[model samples]
Target: MRLRVCGICIQNERILLINHSLYGKDTFFWSPPGGGVQFGETATEALEREFLEETGLRVKVGKLLFINEHIEAPLHAVEMFFQIDSFEGTLKTGEDPELSAEGQVIEQVQFLSWDELTQFAPNQLHRIFSMIGSLDGVFHLQNYIPGQNSGLEK
Candidate 1:
């Protein structure tokens, strides 16, 4: 199983998201900016690196917010999402070093408001995205198990 780290950054009521289409043009998934942790790197360090690589932003990683288990056949990932304490630099689309220019699937990176997110089909977004507006200070650590229906499946 791959261990992944994701950073959550909310500003002006908009949340940062990376648009990815992993399964041809029909399947799109929107999630926070983050990636697999490299060897000998702490989760926080990996998150910082990923944010820089995917969003072109230098961010300070904060407390852990949620732990997610994603198991869908050959792809099993344990993902940790943390709140970004602070950030610097202007927002721009960043590239993943692991993929070639033509192989990259990241289409866009931008801050999306809660209302905008609701327009997407439920299955297209991260499970936690629905609760984004209600999230206040200090969210308790939560767990999302695989196979649980989000009721947004298309």
Candidate 2:
């Protein structure tokens, strides 16, 4: 299992997300910027490093918002989602150091609004975003996801 720390950076009702075609040219997964937490590194440290590495933005990890468990065969991950206290620097698409140049998967990086998010099928978004009623509904995502399968990896 992987312990991944993801950051939630919301501003003006838009959320920052990374578009990754990890499966293939036609398949994609849009999720917050984050990755595995290396040994000896704190979750906050991991989030900061991940945001910079994947979004070109330096961010301060804030309060914990959600703890999600994804236990699929090859993709089990216990993800910790934290609010971004602050951020700086230009936002740009970045590379995943864990993958090789020829295996790059990240395709786009941008802030998406609720309307923009609704255009895609729920499976395309991060699990937390799959059922958000509105941009403000994000604030109600408790530390725990109530239903068992409502928010697992897709």
Candidate 3:
């Protein structure tokens, strides 16, 4: 299984998200800004690097907010989501090194308000995003055992 790190940055009542379209342009998945943890790197370091790579921002990673497992045949991943304490830099869409020039999955990167998020289907967004209303509510680890339905499609 691959290990990934995600950063949660809520500013001005908006959440930072990247439009992930790995499957295709029609299947845009809105998710937190993050990517795989590289070899010999800590989760925090990976997250900082991912933010810079995907959002063009230098961020200070905070406490772990959630631990989620995504299993879909050959695409299994263990993702760790953390709170972003602070950041400095202009925000812009960035690229994923893992993808080829023509295979980049990130289409857009921006801060989306809760009202804007609700406009999409639940499955289109990360499940943990549902708890954004309360930081305390999002500060828990969510483990996924294979085959056990957790009510979260993603």
Clashes by residue pair, model 2: none
Candidate 1 per-residue C-alpha lDDT over 19-138 given as tens digits, one digit per residue, 9 for 90 to 100: 987666667889999999999999999999999988889999998887877766556688888999899998888888999998887878999877788789877987766554443422
Deviating ranges (above 4 Å) for candidate 2:
146-154
lDDT comparison, 1 vs 2, better candidate: 2
TM-score of each: 0.86, 0.91, 0.85
| Candidate 2 displacement at residue 103 in angstroms | 0.7
Instruction: Return whichever of 1 and 2 wins on TM-score.
Output: 2
lDDT of 2 by residue, 1-154 (tens): 7899988899888989999997798988889889999999999999999999999999988999888887655567788889998999999999999889999899999999989988988778877877578877776787756434433565
lDDT of every predicted structure (CA atoms): 0.82, 0.86, 0.82
Candidate whose lDDT is highest: 2
* Residue range with the least summed lDDT across 10 consecutive positions in model 1: 145-154
Candidate 3 residue lDDT tens string, 1-154: 6998888898887788999997688898999999888899999999999999999999999988667777666567888888999999999999988779998889999898877887888788877766455434454545542332445355
Give the lDDT of residue 99 in candidate 3. 77
Instruction: Name the candidate, 1 or 3, with the larger lDDT value.
Output: 3
Pairing residues by index, what is the TM-score of model 3?
0.85
lDDT of 3 at 27: 93
| Backbone steric clashes in candidate 1, count | 0
Top candidate when judged by TM-score against the true structure: 2
